[model samples]
Target: MRKIAFIAFGIALWIFLTPTLEIEVLLTALIASYVAARLVGNVKLRPMKILNFTVLLAYNFLVAVWQSLKIVLGLFDYESKYFEEPAGRDFLEKFEKIVLITLTPFTIVVDEKENVLIIHELKRRKGTE
Candidate 1:
């Protein structure tokens, strides 16, 4: 059943994503989001809800790529003495902040179907709290 698949997937993810483990959080996020979009594709939402989810996913994907590029460029230039310089550190820190923000929408998009049940109180636990 779907529940079994979801549970197995979640356990597998957690095992691989152990706190100190070498898992790629971004990859896990993308997989979860794709699962969500499929689940919602079965829902009977208004046109706007479908559009909202699509736009959020698209933007989140774009931002993730952009942040990754910046992160890579940052690491490449990290040897510059500028690391000790306030401006350089500040730029790196700000870039990190942006990456964190980029993760938020992606996380929310992971539960693409949950948005349709926000008004319910069924105590169903979704991806994020």
Candidate 2:
């Protein structure tokens, strides 16, 4: 069931990413999705959780972009910070978190050591600073 869900999700994602909807494209999507699902192994798919995560990611992306613009316009300061990764997460989950962190313009996972992620962040400058 999990594999089936992953395949379906992959196909949907491929279709959403591709501009064309030809037969060849669909066949490729099916094949690629199947291969990807097989390679990814078991992954539970929770639709509501996924939806919430996607929404949060989009919101963070927009906020990051705004913060980046502010930094570039000299209205903000930048700093490096460390984020502690949650314990007991699998490799795929960790990779997903890393990708999510790196996707934002104002924050990047620059390095990882042990269970910590080294992130660079942009911040609003304090008036006293």
Candidate 3:
């Protein structure tokens, strides 16, 4: 039910935002989920539950890496790439900003009992694995 509402909202938002919306309905939906989670409470993702997010995160990162590689190659062929002019300096700058923003990890901690959202840094170990 929550997911369905979110999807619908995203479609509406994408329609609202239109073509320039780089992420389209999906990003809108994801953002909606984050917002909803926050509104209700900090959503909890236990270690086991974390696996549920692994795939989507992995896919996003993989696509970002692939696009980054393409962007690199595009830069090399800037003189003849894009069928227009290849992505210009502005495009690269904007893309870098988007990727950097989108990929940064934000941990969502949920107060299950109170239904409140808390965003925090994901802790990392200093020692080697």
Q: Which portions of model 1 miss their true places by more than 4 Å? A: 1-42, 75-129
Give lDDT tens digits, candidate 3, residues 1-129: 454444454355445445465655567657775576557453233434234344444566666667568557863222211111122244333333333335544322222222222223333334422
TM-score of each: 0.29, 0.64, 0.25
Error of 3 at 75 (Å): 7.2
Best-to-worst ranking by TM-score: 2, 1, 3
How well is each residue in 70-115 modelled by candidate 2, as lDDT tens digits? 7689775555555555522677567668767777766678777877
Q: Name the Cα RMSD for model 3.
A: 18.6
Q: After superposition, how far is residue 105 of candidate 1 from its true place, in Å?
A: 7.1
Q: Considering lDDT, which of the candidate structures 1 and 2 is the better prediction for this target?
A: 2
Error of 3 at 43 (Å): 7.8
Model 3 error, position 93 (Å) = 28
Higher-ranked by TM-score: 1 or 2: 2
